[model samples]
Target: MDIEAEKARKFRISDFDLIRLLGTGARSSIWEGRDTSTGKSFAIKRTFKQPEDDNRYLDQAINEYEIASRLQHPTIRKVFSLKRVRRVFSIREIHTVMELCLGKTLEEAPPNSLLEKCVVLIEVAKAVHEMNSKGYVHADMKPDNIVVSEKGRVKIIDLGLSCPLGTVKQRIQGTPSYMAPEQLVCWPLDARTDVYNFGATMYWALTGELPPTVVPHQDNSISAHQKSAIPPHIVKPGIPLHLSYLVTDCIKIEPSGRLGGMDAVATRILVIIRELERDQEPTFRIRQRHGTGHGGSFLVSEYRSVAVSERLGPERHVIR
Candidate 1:
């Protein structure tokens, strides 16, 4: 009868009521749906095949469901199942049921404190590492895909671009500002690719500046080379040198030049957190010296800072 009712029926989710539209992308829309029997909420991502469309959107929805459903990490959004409505032999519509992240995306509502931002980044890094460990790469990692709950919990969403490790995509895939150089060159994508994306994200999150990538923002002409990202501490003075170097190292042009993997990224972020928690203004910078092993060694330089969270700003309660 109604549009929501029709969606529920068509998706074979008759026990759930489509409450409202949460977000939209491409030919897909995510709805906040509630289970009638249990009153539990979930995010329902539905995509339709339009007259002018091919099967790209449908394939992406299916890909998201298949990849995300296999991940059980708390920092990653959970996917339940895929539902398809077939018209004759052609599929007309598809739906993916996922965990409803009850807050705004990092792009929409970023945390105020640098420490809090690091916490969020650490969560995402760990989750990405988990995906890599499970033989997948989150080819797309950006602020818009990271949802932060009111209680400060973080959830990484949008697995549509994810692919098996060593996947060399047929076409360039990733947000321009955050796309790794390897992704631009159609090279074999491994955990290092995610490292670059994560680093670019961290760079922007901390300094509010986009890192240099092979693909410029929304430009058709691709750059043949990428310059080093300006260190975060240089862009923003108060940012700790430890973090600044880490961010710079992550966005290195060559995958071999960056950190070993996402696990290393999380470890370095944790070290920064621990140093900041100490609350002492220490004159030292921690630089990750590559080629040592999987875990890079840190070298010291002149730098000083207070606790990141308190120094940056007061932590305000996030209103969902």
Candidate 2:
């Protein structure tokens, strides 16, 4: 949209046929571009003017290039090339060409679409696990940074904020709501920081509400030392008990108490999937639906039965 900034730029959209604007951010704009020679579609992230306030922007760009080029996973967006273009005004711009992702962010995804959300989360967890195993961490993990493809494939994007383990204490970066407490305090981070963020992301997926910015502590509370944290189930009753426990564990005030790493999180999710499958009966299947397009239609029936006591039999069945 800033025509003056782009005028006479070596990486003009005309060089490669422009499709449409994808999105714009503080320092860059993303566009869908087709390579003139190969006719291949790629997402081009172009930064016109570097932020004068933050010297880290250039470092982030270089880190992104380095990180993306080394990663090869189905759930991580692939980088095709990195180009440095200079304009007539003697200003240089950096363009990163990456795989074009087609779906909306998790923030924009509709509520009650539980299945799709779980699938996406699982894919992202796998990707994060891969990164953690390689001794890296996606310091900025949030809904908007994740891309869900048309076919429901999840890809983690925007590695500009990512860094190797124990290298993020220089600045407090990442979305505040989804940021771990250590990140907020500008402490040296590791895989545990990402685990905390992943928990926050899951909390959002399970409940439409976002978690509080800071946790509150109660003197007599069981987790009094943990601070302002509340269980996810307390906010959204529909969340399964196991899942609520898993999420809370990931967000524990002490990083050591959280899941060991992304691999542990992925394993737990896989275990949940298996348990759900094993519990399925020929008469009915219980699964959560995710995203929009259902039009409030109930894909399956809702049935609830009460038990008065451990010795009592299942009580009256209520169907909704």
Q: What is the TM-score of each candidate against the true structure?
A: 0.81, 0.78
lDDT of 1 at 254: 69
Best by TM-score: 1
Expressed as tens digits, the lDDT of each residue in 107-151 for candidate 1 is 865656676577678778878988999999998999989976644
TM-score computed on alpha carbons, candidate 1: 0.81
Q: Per-residue CA lDDT of candidate 2, range 11-41, in tens?
A: 4654587776666676677778999998989
Q: Which ten residues in a row have the lowest lDDT in candidate 2?
A: 311-320
Model 2 bad stretches (over 4 Å) = 1-15, 50-54, 87-91, 215-226, 278-320
lDDT of each: 0.76, 0.69
Candidate 1 segments exceeding 4 Å error? 1-13, 215-225, 280-320
